[model samples]
Target: MRVKVNALILISVFALSSCKTQVLPENTVQTDIKQVVNSADVVLVDVRIPEQYAEATAKDAVNIPLAELSNNIDSLKGKKVVVFCNKGIQADQAVEILKKKGVDVYDGTTWKNVKAIQEEK
Candidate 1:
């Protein structure tokens, strides 16, 4: 009887833990990129390599590769910055770095997404 009850409790704990979903931190909440992109107070940053950015990037986006992002912090100061890359993976990483440094930043995902938001204006 004791073994059976212990097994049931273990199963219940596993079930509850498996059902949990990961939640993003408060600062990582989704922002209204469409509206924010159009504002003059916002700066759009392309975290892709220069070659990738030169090929195609959102209008008015400044190319700052992920490796060089930290070096350009001063340039991004005093503005709402939106960072994007080819697939957004780097952008997510960039957002975390900027957040630590007290920069007002958002994960704009892909440069294509930022361009789409601009075009909708």
Candidate 2:
């Protein structure tokens, strides 16, 4: 019985390990953002709150706070959405949410980074 329990535990561990999600390298993610930044149809979304968004953000970036993302999915359809926040944390979470809903989404790291990319263009 002890051996059977150990074998079951091992199998479960292996299965869980195999289910780990793949995260793209930072450089690779940056490359993806750069490639799409200049596209006319691309949508830059700032995931910060309305107050923070009012202060400053990338030009042409729509204000869609992280908490409101799900309800606003319909507005984001048919466009390549790039999400960013004050820092990269909220943006990363937003990317996961959007990706699950089949939106063409990319993490733009931070609002500052997205603004810089826009200025470069």
Tens digit per residue, CA lDDT, model 1, 33-82: 78788888889999999999999999999999999999999888778999
Across 74-117, the per-residue lDDT of candidate 2 in tens digits comes to 88977899999987999999999998887888889898998898
What is the TM-score of each predicted model, taking all chains together?
0.76, 0.74
The residue-level lDDT of candidate 2 at 52 comes to 98
Q: Please tell me which predicted candidate would have the highest lDDT against the true structure.
A: 1
- Model 1 steric clash pairs: none
Candidate 1, residue 6: lDDT: 100
